[model samples]
Target: MSFDDVLQRGEDELLSTRPRHSLSWILASQFTASTVTAFSKLILTAFYNVELKGLNHLDNAFQYAKDNNRAILTIANHMSTCDDPMLFACLPWRYFFNYDDIRWGLAASNVCFTNKISSAFFSLGRILPCERFGRGPFQPSIDACIRLLSPDNSLNLQKFTLPPPILRNKPSWVHIFPEGFVCQLKSPHENSMRYFRWGTARLVLEPTIAPVVVPIFADGFEKIRPEEIDMKTDYLTPSNIGSTITVNIGKAIDDNVIKSFRDEWKNLCNKYPNKDNNDDLSDELKFGSEARDLRSRVCDYLREQVAQLRLQNGFKEEDPRFKDVNFWKRYTLSRGNSDPDIQFVGLNWAIKEYQRHVKLYNDKGEVIGEGKSERPSNL
Candidate 1:
């Protein structure tokens, strides 16, 4: 599809999100992504001392997902803009050959899709333009991720003359930066991670089939592209060439834990007074308070899972105060003046708070009611 088509249908409907792509686009995307991956591998090997631990866990999870027709969802903490592609460099070379077996990721729309050329480049690399600030996590792009994690049969492949191999009885692989933005601590020994956004909770809870959830922890990427860079160039140049980068791939979350959480979500929906009554309403509107609470809990649990990896990697225990969203808000506000990205974080938090108090809407373009603005007492 053309860029105009993506604009008209909305950023969420980009051809990259669909099950199939034009042959030319598929070829281009594969070539571009492969080349980039190869280059990243070379850079890491030649310049940095990279250590990857527990790679077997990822291999086992990928194999299990492929055998059982289940999707694999990988979550990691974001410390740099190039973390996704750069981290993949540690994988075996065979992974770079098949585009279907590789992972699809989300990127900030404002940063990655500002123009046609950049949009096409990132899209071809299998990145979806997600609205991080304006829509928060309730936008259609988040819904698309849920659809992707569902069973392969949910996709419509007949529309394309030649469906890509990714559409043929294989589950998609999706990667998410749950922290939502680059979060570099002043000291690498600090165990704290930013509060994971609720978008990730939806990915785990709403999928038709529970995905194989794997958590990854990486360090030293922040040195590659430090938040306080001296250069003002448009290109993403790597710095601190000889830093030691360690990547730890934790085991997949237990299946029983995922099932129990899904069951609890179902119970909440069933207990609601108006479950399934509003077919046109989004889950946020239909399930209302229950979804919001469940999402928060799920996000916290997921964040802790990643934090466990950080501890395993020899970092100190996280500070208890970092668990509170308000703490992060205040922290960001304090740093907003000097760091522009931190300013975006503060603004996004405000926008999310505002959205919570605004009028809710159904898919049919009808206003339902005002949302609750009260923060939880414990929080």
Candidate 2:
């Protein structure tokens, strides 16, 4: 069936089964232990020494948001199924510190129905059904986010438009995985990321607002069955010597690079903004493309770096796994062994440029997931 037809059915099905539930109420009731979760989540992020590169991008982003405190919208690349916990774990508090609400996550409608209990309590997925016309009916979360964000249509490029909901409210940060679902393919040949939906791109454009488009790529997160969220035993252990994951935060996307960005907001702002979107892509037809050349550059850069690490310095000094030809984790996940010529490259492609840092989450004194631990979880 055509994409439009599928979308129509999806929308129709969702509207018919529209579940009227209050997020605020659900969160308050389901997460009665939130006081417990807050402490745990905070300590894990703060002391863990989890550093983000290109964080200055968000630093500057926060400044732009100073006007009305319109919340920042972060677009992240989705890799693992269990990426949400890590998402909360990955970000620094300052990112969400200023706003009354920091974490706003979106999930495909399917996830809501499929895992209602979990989505309601622990890793609840907010259900939003999209129409073929790019509209969802009476979604409170979306409406609240849009209202809180107070998006100003004065900043967008033509092709991308922000929905009206974004303009009404002010949010600190809204985390969105535009891929729409979790990545669940196999490994050694893993990493067939779905194409990012343009909805996010449109949001960036329309709000006449430019949010910190934090492009993140997460590794080490795979299919997480609801039955196996127990980090104390099965999930948390070191899977494979080579089983390392990487999450990279790429540069932001802006109208400074798109002529359409300037044209859209020329009349709105007193100052005529500069429009020379620095794109690496040589697309002859598509205009105002900032991430146009992102794909080729990321691929090329990863391939070369990985190749160098394998052939030259080699990972033998740091990781002995690289010493054995059969122990291919280093070559596969390392920045030195990627080869573009080989179509079987893995997901490490998105994070090849990032430095991987690991900090242990010992429930030694802390309360682990769902009362498993005693030390308030974060320890």
Candidate 1 ranges with C-alpha deviation above 4 Å: 1-12, 15-20, 154-168, 188-191, 231-237, 273-287, 333-379
lDDT of each: 0.70, 0.39
Across residues 1-379, which tens digit of lDDT does each residue of candidate 2 receive?
0112222232233322333234464455334334434654554444333434455665666566666445576665465645665545555555433323445556543334235565444333323422111122223334333332433343233433344212123544666665454444343334434444444433343233445444555544443222123535555442333333344555444535433543433332222222343211112212233332332232223222222322222122223222232333344455335543333222332221221221112323222322111222221
Model 2: weakest 10-residue lDDT segment is 278-287
Clashing residue pairs in candidate 1, if any?
none
The TM-scores, one per candidate, come to 0.79, 0.46
User: Which parts of model 2 have CA positions greater than 4 angstroms off?
Assistant: 1-51, 95-101, 113-119, 122-148, 151-169, 184-189, 223-245, 258-379
Predicted model with the maximum TM-score: 1
Clash count per candidate: 0, 32
True lDDT of residue 106, candidate 2: 65
